[model samples]
Target: MKQLIFSLSFCLLAMSSLFAQGIQFESGSWADVKAKAKAQNKPIFVDAYAVWCGPCKWMSANSFTDASVGELYNSGFISYKFDMEKGEGPAFAQQQSIRAYPTLLFFSPDGELLKKAEGARDAEGLISLAKPYLKANNNANQEQTTTDNNWESLNAKAWEYYETKSNRSDLSKALKWANTSIEMNRNWYNLDTKAHLLAKLDRNKEALELAVDAILAAQDAGELAEAEETMELLRKLRNN
Candidate 1:
């Protein structure tokens, strides 16, 4: 049984090597990989995975070996794989708050975490993940320096966009982005935005209660203008 396990492991390794010319991975400690990334002036791409995870295994077997994925990753980044359940992986996993089987983390060479995504991704999906990070790296001439994670900022951006953009797709994106902010914090403004978005969708049952709640909360806080605006929203929601 041990021999069979060894043979299987060897085969997997050999197969991975055949795809090695694609997304070549670093062969050293995690810290070493980070140092190499810094030295090379490149970002870090880590595949935080568990051995027994089926999706992790599938990704290793399939997506990691895709030539296009390899070309993009190998050209621009230092890649590393770690089994989060074992050895030094556990310590890093805890620091990174990795609660899932397969978490992909992208980091700056200076070791700042830039982005993260959960679950399995196909080659195309994985490639997509690299795009924003790549853009941030390549487009120094662009306005935004980093991706926005704060819900308040996102909520406000959504509001500004929604107010100015008449495109149906843009409206949907604004509403969706506001929904993310609402999920992050249910402050009055967040709830109000969510209520408005939900009302736009004709999601009356969901929108009505939140709009009313925001109105009452504003009234309690002596925020008369806010309460009045919320009441106006409640009227619109009811009319919907």
Candidate 2:
């Protein structure tokens, strides 16, 4: 009878530990996090959010519920959800330089900041962003090489040449820069930049093609505003 009782007790303890290990959003004092993180040797993921942001709500409702996200987060992180306008949450947000709602900050077990991301990211995007930071040796050199390039900078430079050059003289340089931006990050903004440059060079047909691609990609990513705007611009350009 003593042996059987010990086995049952051990099983219950194991089950309890497994349950505690699952992905859960905790709301509490930052002090509470310090001990838990030390005990688990896991990083903390802080969601700095505000009540008034629609995208923040959408991320909480849709992105946070994703199965893969839940699995990865459960196993890999200690998660906290903070309301940026209330409680100690606001103070923490300010300390972390969180100027935007729905900012996500990742910190190492020792409380060193690993990465910070702002804006609404879907499940896949969030997973992609989190994977690199969870590495065993999360060094700055490894991070610098993996970080996404600033496509906007390249696009802005290309646009400057397109606007100033006479007789379409620098169109080739504009096209090259725009293409490089797209290759670096194939997001709606970069695609639109490429389309605009093509249109300026009087390559209306090519512009229309790139615009359509951008519209479809944005729509598929659930960026309705960008998709609609790009589609409308493409229609108008094709008509003219």
> What does the lDDT come to for candidate 1?
0.77
Q: Put down candidate 1 lDDT per residue, 1-240, tens digits, no spaces.
A: 999999999998876665565678788899899899768857789999998999999999899989889878987789999889887899999998999979999986656677778999999999999877666555421312243778888788777765676543345456656777777876678677767766665567888998887776666667758566668878876776
Worst 10 residues of 1 by lDDT: 138-147
lDDT at residue 33 of model 2 (Cα atoms): 80
Off by over 4 Å in 1: 1-21, 140-240
lDDT by residue (tens digit), candidate 2, 130-197: 78756632332243344345777777766676668643324544565678788887877778777877
On the 0 to 100 scale, the lDDT of residue 29 in model 2 is 80
Candidate 2 clash pair list: none
TM-score of each: 0.51, 0.49
Best by TM-score: 1
Q: What is model 2's C-alpha RMSD?
A: 17.7
Q: Rate the local accuracy (lDDT) of all candidates.
A: 0.77, 0.74
